[model samples]
Target: MAKIAFILLCHKDPEGIIRQAERLTAVGDCMSIHFDASAPKSEYDRIRKALDGNPNVTFARRRVRCGWGEWSLVQATLHAVEAAVSAFPGATHFYMLSGDCMAIKSAEYAHDFLDSADIDYIESFDFFGSDWIKTGIKEERLIYRHLFNERSNKRLFYGAMELQKRLGWRRKIPADLQVMIGSQWWCLRRRTIEWVLDFTRKRKDVMRFFRTTWIPDETFFQTIVRHVVPDAEIRSRTLTFLMFSDYGMPVTFYNDHYDLLLAQDFLFARKVSPEARELKRRLGVLYASEGTEFRISNEGQRLYRFVTDRGREGRRYAPRFWEAEASLGRERELLIVICKKWHVARRLAGIVRQELDLPVIEYLFDEGKTELPDLGGIQSTIEKRTRHRRALMRMLFDYHKTDRLLVCMDPRNFELLQDFCADRATTRLLEIQCRFCDDYLTGHAKRIGLAGEQAGPEAMARLLPTIRNDLRHESDRIADAGFAHLNRMRETAGPDENAVPLAAFLSIPEDKARAIAAMENLFSD
Candidate 1:
C-alpha cells in the first residue's frame, strides 16, 4: 500500500483539529498542519502541545493569515503542502483537506479507496463561464480585476470596482493561460504537488495575476493543474462532501445531515460543528465504532426522516405558488444539464447527478413544449423553471446564488449556453459526462477480463488486483462559438483568436462585435 500524508489548512477550532489529528494517528496516517498566521502564537503553542512529540505529525513553520477568496488562502495551502512534502518526502500520496473536514469512512477504507484510485482526485474545468462561480457573480470574479481583499471597506471597494469595470479596467484573463477552477480540496501524489509548486514559482506572472483575482484559492492551484499537469493521471472530483448554504457559506452539519452525509460515497465531510450537541454526540459514537461499511442506526434514520420532513417544507425552488417566510436555500453547487429537448436533458441530468454527486438543475432552452422529464425511479429532477431559457436566466441570475456547472449534453442547447458563455465567462461547463463511477467501473471490469458477473462496489474492490484505469485526458468538446477562444488556447494558436478580448465584453457595436467574434472564429467551430 502507498503511504499517505495528510495536509490540513485550518483557521479556527483547535479542539476539532486535534481530534482529527488523533483520529488520523489512530488510523496510522501521518499529518502536516498549518495554522492561520493571524492566530496568536499562544494558540499555536496550545495546538503544538496537543500534538507534541507525535512522530507522525509535523507543523508548518510559515503560518499564513488566510482570508476567504484572497491569495492568502492559496498561500496557506501551499505552505501546508510544502511542509507535508518536506516531512514525508517519500510518501506516495498526499490528501489535502481543511481543518473542519473529518473522515466519514474508517482509515482502512479511506486508504483502500486511495490505493484503488490510480489518478489524482482533483476537479478542474475551463474557467470563464465554465463552472468557476455562480452565473451573476462570474463576470465579477473572472473578468474584473479584484484589487481589494475582504478586509477592505466593501461598499467603497465594490463601488470603485464597478467604476473601474466601466472604465475598461476589467480585462479578460490572459490568453497564454487557461483558467481552470474547481473545488479547492484535493488528494494528489507527491510529484503532482511538487510540479504545481515548481511551476507556479517559475511563472511569477501567473502567480501575481492570481493574487489580483478574486478567490485565488479556487483558481490558482486548479489553473496550475491544467497548465502543468493537464495530461497527468487525474479525475475531476473531490472525494469530500461539503454542503454550502445559498450564499456559499459552509453549512454546519448536525444530526439531520448525518444520514445524508453517510449516504454519499465520500471520504470526508466538513464543518461538523462542535456546537451542535446531538451532532457532536452522534459523531463521537461514529468515531468509536469501526469497519468500512457505513450503516445508519434505526435512531439515525428516524432523526433523518424528521429532518427531511421539515426540510421538504422548505422547497428548494420557487417558480410559482408557494408562500414562505424565507425562500428555500439551494445546493451550493448545481450540475446544470443543458440540452435541447426536455427528454435528452432529463436523461442526461439523472446520470450526471448520480455520477457527479451533485444536484441536477436542468437548464433547457429549446424544449418547444415537450413535457418536462419525470426522471422516474432513477433520480428525481427538481423542476427549477428548467425548460425555458428566460426562466433559467432568472433562476441563475436572480434568485439562487450558488455555483453552477453547466453541461452541454447535446448540440441543441449549445447556442443558448453559448450566449451565456459570452456573458458569464466563468460558469464552468462540461461537454463530456461519465456514468456513475461505480456503474462504469463494474461494466469496465467485464471488458477488462475480470470475473465479475455482478459489478458492485465490493465485487470491483475484490477485482482491484490492479487499478486498470481508463479515465479521459483532454477529452471535452468545444461546440459553442462563445468558447472557441478556449480551443485556440489549447491548440497554442498565436496572437489572434487566443482569448476572449476585453473589447468583446465592452459594449461594442453589433457589427463590430460580429467582426471581433468572426476574427476569433467564435461563430464557427
Candidate 2:
C-alpha cells in the first residue's frame, strides 16, 4: 500500500473527525490530529479517548488558536505537517483533512490519481493588484472611499491597505514575477512540502508581515509558494469530490441530491450532515462490490443502475415514504416564520395570521419556545435578528408544507429573504414592507443637505409613492414579457415561397424554407 499521511485540524467536531478517520483508514497509511488550544479541556480529553488504541492515529502536543481571518490556523497546519512528515518520512503525499471532509471515491482510485498527478492539488488563484490588498487600509478618507464608493468592509478594508504600504512592502509584484492565490486545505507532495516550509522559515520579513494580517491562511501559503516556484506544475484547484463556497467552506448536502452526488466524478466530499446517514449507507454498499450494478425503480419508471467506484453499481429504490408512518392527527400544513428579533417575528406572525387568516408556526432560536412578546417594547439587535432570519429562511426552503412564505422587515432584510428563496426550489414568496408611523417620528431631524447624514422623513415619504408605483409597473411588465416570450416560442414559422436549392440555401433560415426542400436531399444519409 502507498503511504499517505492524513492530517486533520479540528475544533469542536471530534465525532466528525473520528468518522472521517475511520473512512480514510481504509486508504491512508497514518492519521494525525491537532486540536485547537482554546477548546474545552473536557472536549479535548473526550477526543483523545475516542482515538485510543488506533495504531495509526497520533495527537499533536502543541495546540493552536483558530479564528476567522486569522494566522493561527496556518501555524497549526504547519505544525501538523511537520509532525506527520517526521512520523511517516517515507510517505509520498500529505493529505490535509478537515473534520467536515468525507471520501466520495474508492481508496484505490484516489491513490491512483495522487500517484499520477505528481503536481500538488491545492485551490489557487492569481491575486496581483486585486481588491484583497485594499482590505488592509484604515485611514478615514480611504475607509470612507471603500465604504461608499467601493462597497467593501469599511474598517478592515482601510486597515489592510494602510498596513501593506507602511511595512515598506512591494505594492505591486514585479513584471517578471508571478503571483498565485490558493486555499490552505490541500494535498502536497513531499518535495513541495519541504520547499514550502524552507521558504517560509528563510523569509523572516514575510513571516512578520503575515503575523498580524487578516486572512493569513489564504495569503501566507500562496505568497510563499508563488515566491519560490511560480512555474511549479501545481493543480490550483481542489481535486476533491465536493464543491465549496468561494471561501473554501463546506456547504450542506441534502438527501434530495444523492443521485447527483453519485454521478459526480470526485474522490471526496465534505460536511455531510447527520440527516444523510441513509444515503451514505447506500453509497457504501454500491462501492463495496466491484463490477456489480444496482438499479433504482421510481414510481413505475424503468430501473436504472448508477455507476460506482471500481466500475461497480448499485440499485436505488424510490424512497419509501410510506414506510415511515406519520403521527396521527398531524397538521396538514405548517408555515414557520422566523425573525432575528422575537418581537419582529412575533409582529410579522400576527400580521400574517390576520392578513392571510392562517396561524403561522413561529420559531426564534435566541428565545426559547415561549409565547410571543409584546411588539411595542421589543428591542432588536442586528446580529441576533439576522441569525433567526437565516434559520427561518433555511427551514422554509427545506419544508414542503411551507407553501406561502411572508417576510415583514426592512428593504435590506427583505432582499436577503428573496435571495434565500431563490436558492431553494420554491415560488411562494410575499413581502410586507415595514415603515414607522409619523407619530413615532419625533424630534429627529434627518439631514438631507449633509453628505454623510441620513435623508429626512418628509423626503422618504415623498419617495414612497413613486417607489410603490414603479414596483407595480415593473411587476406587470415582467409578467407580460414572460407570456409574450412563451407564445412566440410555441408558434411555428411557415415556409417561404421564394426558396432556393438545398445546397445554395445555407444562408436562408431553415424554418423559412421547410416546404420546398427536395425529398432526397432532406432525407439524405
Candidate 3:
C-alpha cells in the first residue's frame, strides 16, 4: 500500500491549516508543515500545539520568510520536504499543498490512486519553448537576475532588469539542466522526491543560480524532476484542482462553489476561502468517509468554460442603450429600416423580407429581448447588446449562409446609425418618417416597464426632434409618411410596382440597387 506524505506551506489562517492537516492525516497519511517565518508567532503556536500529539504530523525545523519571485519560497518547500522525508522514511509518494488546500476525497482513495502507479504527477514544460507565461519578462526571467521582490518593489525590480539589459549581462544555465516551468503544486514518488533533495544538496552552483531566479519555486522542482525522470515516468500534470482569474490571481473557492468543488476529479483543491465553513464541513465528511465516487459533471465544465471564455474574450463591451453605437455587420446586403414607431418598421421589414427572400429581424436594437427570425426571442440584457450584434452578424454571414439581412429598429437608437450605414458598398439605409405614433410609443413604454415617466406625449414631443435631426445629418433616404401610409401598405399586403407613392417608398431605388450590385463583384469568393 502507498503511504502518501503531504507537505503543506502556509503563512496565515492557522485554524484552516489545522483543519486541513487533521483531514489529510486522518487515515494514517503523514504531513510536514512549514509556517512562514514572517507570520505572527501566535498563529504558528496555535497550529503547532493543536497537531503536536498527532504522530503523522510534524513541523519543519527551519521556517523561511517567503516572498513573491524570490528563493525563500523554494527554500521553505525544501525545508518541509526535508522534514517529511526524514520523519516518514517508508512513504511511497510526497504531495505538495498549500495551507488553503483541502482534501475532497478520502485518504484511502488517494493512497489507492498513487499505489497504482509510481510515476510522478506534475506540470512540466520546456520554459523557452512554451507559451505558458502570458505577460512578463519571459527569457529574461531566466537569464537576468531578479534581486528585488516583484510584489513589494516592482519599479526597482523592473528597473534592475532594464539596467542589466543595457549592460548585456546574462547568466548561462547549468549545462546539464534544461529550464522547465510548471504549477507549484505537484505529487511525486518518494524516489523522485529523494533524488531531487539529494541533487539540490550537492549542486551548490545550481542553487546559487536559482537563488536570484524569478519565482524559483515554480521552476526549481519542475526543472529538476524533468532533468532526471524519463519522459514515461512523469505525468506532467498536477493532481490538485486550481484556477486563476484574469489578473493571474488564484481563484478562491467558497461555500457557493459546492457543486463546482464536488464535481472535480482531483483529490484536492487549493486556495479555498477560510470563511467557507459549509464547504469545509461537507468536504471534511467526504475526506473522512468512504463510498463516495468522484465523477466529472457538466457544472464543472460550464464553470471552466465561463472562466476561460471570460479570460479570452473578456466582458462584452456595452455602451449605454441610448448612446450605443451601431456595430457594422459583415460585408453583405444589409437594409436597415428605421422609423419613429417600430410597428411600421416591422410591417415594412416583412414586405422587404417577402420580396427579397431575406431574413428580417424585428426590433433588432430594442432594449428588451431581441426577436430573431427563427431563434424566437433571445433574452438580451442591456449589457449583452454587443453580443447580440455579433450574433446578428454571424447569423447573416455565417450560420444561414445568407448574404442579405433586413433589420427593423426604432429611430430612438439612431445615435450611430448614420456612421454605420454611411458605407454604401454593402449597406442601404431607409427611414419611414411617421407624422405621429403615440399609441405605439405608449405601448412600447408600458411593455418596457417605463410607462410611469416615459409614456406621455410630453416626453415623446421633447425627444422626437432630436432623434429625427440626428438621422437627417448623414442620411438622405427618409420618406415622409404617416400611419395612413403604413395602414395602406398593410392592407395592400404585397408590393405594388405601379402604385403611385407607396411603390416609390417600398421599392429599392434604381441607383442604390446598381451601386449595391457594383460592389458585389468586389466581395465575390
Candidate 4:
C-alpha cells in the first residue's frame, strides 16, 4: 500500500490550486498546501474554504514570506511537510510539487511505480564538479553570506556580494556535509523524509549557514539526503517534468501543449499556464484514471529541442543574438574558413580533406548553398538567414560529432562574422586573403545594390578597412594571409619571406602534410 503525501508550495492561482488539491485527494492521496505569505488573504481563504471538508487536505499553520532564491521558500516547505507528517501518518512517500503542477500520468501509475522501489528520486550532484549551474556564482553561493533577496532587490543583493568580496569575508560550510544541488522538486521515502527533518532540527549551525545562502531550497534537502541515502537507493532524476529555458525561467505549458504533455512519461508537470483550462481539465481526467502501462519518452531532450525550435515565436526579430544563443545551448569548438573567392575555399577544402584527413564542410553559410541542402533555400533573405543562422550551425555541429570542424563561409557576411566573434572562446578563424580583390569587390557591390553594380578601386578601398577591423579582434583565435594593402596583416609572412608567399600558399601542393604544417604555423603567437 504505497501512499504519497504531496507538499504543494503555492503562491498564486487559488482556483487552480483548489482544483489540484481536490483531484489529488479524490485519488486517495493527501495534500499539504503552503500559500506564500506574499499571497493575498482572499486567495488563501478561497483555497482553504474549498478544501475545508476534505479530510486529506491540510494547510501549513505558519506562512513564510517567500521570494525567489530566498531561504523562506525552504522554510515554507519545511512547515508544510511538518503539517503533512502530522496529518497523513500512513503516507509512505512525501512528494514535493508546485502550485501549477498537474499530473500528466494516472495516480495508479505513480503508486505502482513508487511501490516497486523504496528508492528516492532526486538529482543530487557534487556542487563543485557539476556543470549544472549554468549561470551565476556556483561555488560562491555556498561560501558567501547572502542575506538580501535577489528577486526583491537585485542591486542590493549583488552589491552586498561585491562588498563581501572586497572585504575578503567568507563563511566556512559545515565540516560533516558535502554541498550538493539539484531541482528543488523531489520525491523522498517517509523514513528518508523523517531522517531529513530530524537532521535539520538537530543541525542548527548548518541551518544558520543556509539561512542566508542563495537559493537554499535547491541545495538544502539535496545535501542532507546524500549523507543518509546510499547511491544505489537514489535516482538522478525527478518524477515531475520541469524544463527551464537556458535563461533559468521555467517553460510554461499551454492549451496547445496538451499533446506534448501526454507524450511525456513524467508523472507530473509544473509551471502550466493558469489560463490553460482545457489542458488542465483533460489532464485531470487522465490523472484519476487507472493505467498499468506507461509510455516512455525522452522528454528532457525532446523539450530542449522544443524550446530551441518551437520557442522561436516573434523572438527572432529581437536584436539581441543571446536571445537565440540561449535557445541553442552552449558553444562548441567551431572552425571557420574565410576567403573572398569560393574557388580558394574549394581548393583549401580538398587539400585539408586529402592531406590532413580532416573533415571539410564547404559554403556552410552561403546563400542557397549549405552543407544541409534541405535547409538551404531559406538563406535567400538576410532576415531569414540571420534568424536561423545559429540553429543551422548548431544542427551542423550536432550532425558531425567531432572535436574540430572546418566550415567555409563568405567573409562579407558581417552578421555571421559578428556571431563568430561574439563566441570567441570556441570560434577558430582561418582567413586566406586573395591578391585579386576585383571579383570579391564586384560581387559585394552587387549584393549591396551598389550604383551600376560595378567594382571600382574606391569601393574596394572603402570596404577594406571595415573587413580588416571585423576580422582582427584582440585575443581572438585567428590566422590569416594577404590583406597587406589594408595594412593589418599581423602575422602574415612579409614580402621578404619569399618561401611561403601568399600566392604560393594558395597553390595546389604536392607535399600535402607540409602545406597543412605551414598553415598551422600561421596561427603561432
Each candidate: RMSD to true structure?
21.3, 24.5, 14.2, 17.0
Each prediction's Cα lDDT score? 0.58, 0.49, 0.70, 0.72
> 1-525 in candidate 3: lDDT tens per residue?
988899999999898889888887887889999999999999999999999999999999998898877999999999999999999988888999988887777776877888788699989989999988998778888899999988899899999999999999988999998999999899999889989998998999899989989988779999999987898999988889888776888888898776556556677888788888998898888787877665443234334543365334213343344333434444566656666556566655665566567777777566466654453333345334444554445444555577666667665443334434443325555555544344544454445433333223544453345334444532332233212222122222222311333333345574433332232122111
- Residue pairs with backbone atoms closer than 3 Å in model 3 (clashes): 122-237
Q: What is the lDDT of candidate 4?
A: 0.72
Give per-model TM-scores: 0.57, 0.50, 0.65, 0.62
Give the C-alpha lDDT of model 1. 0.58
Per-candidate total of colliding backbone pairs: 12, 18, 1, 0
lDDT string for model 1 (1-525, tens) is 766788888877788788778777664678899889888778788889999888889988688777777888888788878888888766778887887676666666667778885778887878755754764456577677776664566776587688987898867576688888899888887788889889877988777678778887777877787776655577877877776654656766766565556545677787776766566556545654666475422222222333344334324332232222122223322233332223444554454446444344543333233333443311222233332333344344333343544333343333344444444234334342223244444554454334224334544554343333222211222442445333212223322442233123222344443343333322121
lDDT of 2 by residue, 1-525 (tens): 356788888887666667656556644467878889888878888778977677677777578876665567788888888877777777788777776555555566566668776677776666654443444342222112121212335476556555756775433222443344556667777887888888777766566556655565766676666556545677776655554443435566666545544434455556566667766665555434344322211111001111111123111111123312221112222232322223444553564356445435444323343333333222144333343444433344344244444333322233333333333323222222222333222211122111112333443444345344433443343334332111110011222322232112222354433333312222111
Across 1-525, the per-residue lDDT of candidate 4 in tens digits comes to: 789999999998898898889988898999999999898999999998899899999999999988888899999999999999999999999999998898888889888889988799988988888998888788779888998888778899889999999999988999998989999989999989899899888999989998989999889999999988888999878888878776778988888776556556578898788889999998898888975454353344443553374345334344364534543334465666676566766765676677655667787556454445345555455466566766656655566665456677765454465565565335555566544344554454445433123333553454445434443431132223222211112234443332233223333343443445355334321
Ranking by TM-score: 3, 4, 1, 2
Better of 3 and 4 by lDDT: 4
Please say which candidate is ahead in lDDT: 1 or 2. 1
TM-score for predicted model 3 compared with the true structure:
0.65
Q: What shift in Å separates residue 244 of candidate 1 from its native position after superposition? A: 2.5
Candidate 2 ranges with C-alpha deviation above 4 Å? 129-179, 229-232, 241-250, 280-525
Name model 1 segments beyond 4 Å from true: 129-132, 150-152, 256-259, 276-291, 294-525
Best by lDDT: 4
